[model samples]
Target: MLCGVHNHDLAPNLSGHLLAGRLRGEEKQRVIDMTKSLAKHRNILTDLKEKNKESVTLI
Candidate 1:
């Protein structure tokens, strides 16, 4: 008997994978827009964290 190792990981294109075969029409677009917004916010937060770290290191 042979078994395969399976990994449950989020796909690299998470937004597309999340929306694929799940949503359509306006709803899908809404989700995509929401993801974009969330990504923007995440980037902003990451920048802030890096800046905070730099300031802390300098002090």
Candidate 2:
């Protein structure tokens, strides 16, 4: 939701739909796109996490 933060992981409904395998065809493709976008976002989050850890160690 909110642009790139397709944090379906943060909500139960999206996870339920995904796990249930209820989505079909284009709907599934749409979900895949959303998940891929999230994966890209995750890479940034991981970098930020590592940077945060470094900053904490420096403190």
Candidate 3:
């Protein structure tokens, strides 16, 4: 299963599984950080696309 910022709704479920597993604290933090980064990047890409569409409409 894929886990990332895009699927935040699944975070609680995933966290439960992770907590039940042997993943270390540091590793878990890394995963959380990575997810946040992915989400930020997705937002940036979405904003850029919207701006591009607006510019295209103006052209």
lDDT of candidate 3 over 1-59, digit per residue (tens): 25634643545433235444443465446446756777565554454446444221110
Q: Give lDDT per model, in order.
A: 0.45, 0.46, 0.44
lDDT value, residue 14 of candidate 2? 40
Segments in model 3 whose C-alpha atoms lie over 4 Å from true places: 1-21, 39-59
Residue-level lDDT of model 1, residues 1-59, one tens digit each, is 22664566556543334334343355346546756777564554454436444221110
N/CA/C clash count, model 2: 0
Better of 2 and 3 by TM-score: 3
Candidate 2 runs further than 4 Å off: 1-21, 39-59
Residue 2 of model 3, lDDT score: 53
List the lowest-lDDT window of 10 residues for candidate 2: 50-59
The Cα error of candidate 1 at residue 4, in Å, is 35
TM-score of each: 0.27, 0.28, 0.29
Q: Which whole-number lDDT from 0 to 100 does residue 47 have in model 3?
A: 49
Alpha carbon deviation, residue 58, candidate 3 (Å): 48
Model 1 clashing residue pairs (backbone): none
